[model samples]
Target: MIRAQLELRIPNMTAYETITAAKKSAIPDDAAMLRAAVELTKDISAARAAIYWPDCFLSAALGYGALAGAVLLRETWLAVVCALVAALALYRALLFIHELTHIHRNALPGFRFAWNVAVGIPMLTPSFMYENVHTLHHARTRYGTAEDPEYLPLALMKPWSLPVFVAVAALAPVALLIRSAVLVPLGAVIPPLRRVVWERFSALSINPGFRRRPPEGEFGRMVFWQELGASTWAITLIASTQFIGWRPLLIALAVFSLTAVLNQLRTLVAHLWENDGEAMTVTAQYLDSVNVPPPGWLAPLWAPVGLRYHALHHLLPSLPYHALGEAHRRLSAHLGAGSTYAGAHYGGMMPLLAKIARSTMGRR
Candidate 1:
């Protein structure tokens, strides 16, 4: 029978049953809880999400302005200060890409275009790369499996791979520059090259095994223009370096590299990363993900723009980024001490990193 075949295909029915029972007991009605949270936050305006645009623009301006001031002043101490500030600001601004994915197109008209022009193109990480790709990671059947483009089992990898994973992000700026400046143009002219580029270079994914399918319809047109914009920006930056001098370019690279590194660090603790390509249950995904709650002063610095409630986001993917905090507060108050949600809270980054390190070493 088809039911028997499905049971055979599922790796561990015992484990699945255990997880299902746990989830049911912990949150008696997950759907109702989510619906209530949605209703509770319904009166909150979607326009609050649009307000992120000005903040992101201002942050980017401050970052670049400080870097320029540092270059003009020609002081090592000032340059160091400027670089740190730039890194923080740029990292925060770049995170709007995540927000852009969730915000309805009609709710924030022209905001996506503004963001692409200001942050996405200049950084060579256009929004198109992430738009369609991230949604897959949130898919119920895809998450924590090989099909999830955004996930990898870091805790199950070799102990040495952890440091390498985080350190490699420092080189992302160079890789992104090459991707935009060299790959995009070449791919445009050659059909075969375009297919290769689409599969390999198009997505903002971390999984090595994931390959992107070619964009189609309106998505294809959007991808084309976004790529063109990034290519033009990359070419301009390269050409301008010759006349404007390389110092500013070097500062830009440094800022980008630092931002990438900071993001990688945040990502490292985003989850326990122990799924090992298994098709996880919803509770398993929530348990594997992390949430760093209050009293952690540095949580916002690392997990900015509502990422601090990452596990909760997975549970309620439709909730806008601006409403996550309030949702978490409501969910916590409603769910109380016995809820499975408590298991997702890591308290702070240091503890999370330590737990991951222990898990990595223990697997060794």
Candidate 2:
């Protein structure tokens, strides 16, 4: 989904370790590794704390606003307006999933289950799986190519292929759902087909390299419990909501779907535009993925959902969404002008899509 270029000059190990150790303490060596680990943990914790409140408020407001709009609004035009407002709310909820899962529980009390039910299950994804995948993304984000499961493989793009490339790409999510719900349950009995299916998934955003083996051991049990517990709650909510009438339920589901689409479009705008040729092969964080001149009035609304300063988020995913603007400012100051880490919103979809198509097609 990303077409950004990333270049990381690997540091010399011994010297890098020494420097990292130096930053933590005056210790010449030995306990340097522990200190570095502790320092990283501390930094991540601090970042998590910075954005916790706004994230919670964003979630509550989105949920309540959707409910309120659904209850108060009638008429066809009002339903359209309700859908727009609900879509924005749901987008924030999805982003909240992305944010809360990254947050360490010790950094924020009660974030564990709150993130699971409120964010994960509503999005129809398992939080435990996301925790593993997301954390590893931070670990090896810059390690692109087919090796890094978090990125789409180079050969995966068939833009000029038959059945039309764009249509195939757009239909990918439906294909994924079918595979997950159907083929995945068949297990080892379908080894040959499974292998082919696995290859297809391997080409997508999440690399199968770091995929969690569900039936393995202790961690497997924990993942199961988390997934099961959250899913039970989500199912209960959905089933109980029948009493609230199908109208509201359908409206909410529609809102969630539209919002997810909007979020995806926003993601493409921020990250998928081709830069230099080499840049297309890199991780999203390095591709100069940024916003393009978003409206002033929209900033407040977008800021809460982690859209206003997306470039910074790409660079530093561990930073809380709320702290993104500040982080962008500071990083921008450090890097000076022409830094891709800072960005504003660009207007409209057609122009950007045209630019991306031309770039991808190798046209001037």
Candidate 3:
């Protein structure tokens, strides 16, 4: 009913190129479009520190500022307003974690540290949560398979799973607190628990069956420091309630919970989520992912940090967040609307979300 009302409101919206479970076999990749995507975007692939630093820092700064106002204002309507602002700003800041997984570590020196200090550890989502995990989603053989940490066949699951998938994220702040403040700290004392936490709870992933291998090499060393920072922060946050009282902590948790929910909603439509755990070709994976591109508006707000061009991101995983818009424009104009590259471009977030929701209900 909400979707029907939304569709009626957008009477002039572009008709979407919907892909459902039944439509999988018919949607093949255009090899020429693939080559064009790689070739055309080469010049823009390098991450610009100029764009990365300010965006992440400002978003984090604004988020925390608003969160403070919310807590200070108490239960008033203005506090509610501030809380919402905090959620949105922090959601934008938090999504930089996705960019962290893709961009070269050396490109933005101190960015990883700054982001962790400002946004990541405080939010209990250090860059390490995504660093090793998200790359597998782009692996040629792992994309859309059980091995893909981020892949989930939501369209193939029962209709109930859709709401469950999204609703569960509302508890993410609480879950992260427990994971960091309790499980991780305990895991440090118990070797078996540490391995379990590493295998099961370490990643920011959607696939229930996906278990991450132990972190190795310099990556492992990086993980240790990040984990220590996150755990320490989490412990401090929990312990603060005794002195500062529950009001501030509860309000902050509520704000973070809202942020998590927004992200989960974005994740819901990030892809069609219809691969059925099979290995897919690169183009097939790209087609499965969704892009909520421009002229519709509001995508950048919901799918911030260049995530609005998610399908294109899968095609050229190294293209930095700031460059995605230009890359998308070049490819869209070059390939035209009828090409496979255009297959993933949708009108807007609601329609794309409605499309995915409908898919789970056994409709096209």
TM-score of 2: 0.62
Model 1, C-alpha of 355: deviation from truth (Å): 0.8
lDDT of 3 by residue, 163-251 (tens): 89999999999999999999999999999999999998989998889888988999899999999999999999889999999999999
Which of the numbered candidates is closest to the native, going by highest lDDT?
3
- Order of models, best lDDT first: 3, 1, 2
RMSD to the true structure for each prediction, in A, is: 5.3, 9.8, 6.0
Q: Model 1 Cα displacement at 41 (Å)?
A: 3.4
lDDT of 3: 0.84
- Report the C-alpha lDDT of model 2 over 1-364, residue by residue, as the tens digit: 0111111211122111112211111212222222332343334325454466556657657765765676568877876776777666655665665665565556677665666566555444445545555554444323333343454422224445212423344443344334444554443368765555444442224444544323357656755565455445545555666777657656655666555455545544444432222222112333334444334455545434566565445445566666655554444455434322222234445445554555445431
Candidate 1 residue lDDT tens string, 80-192: 89888888888888998988887788877788998998889889999998899999998877987899999988877778888998899999998888888988899878889
* 1 versus 2: better lDDT goes to: 1
> Candidates' TM-scores?
0.89, 0.62, 0.92
Model 1 pairs in collision: none
TM-score of 1: 0.89
Name the lDDT value of residue 339 in candidate 1.
53
Clashes, model 2: 8
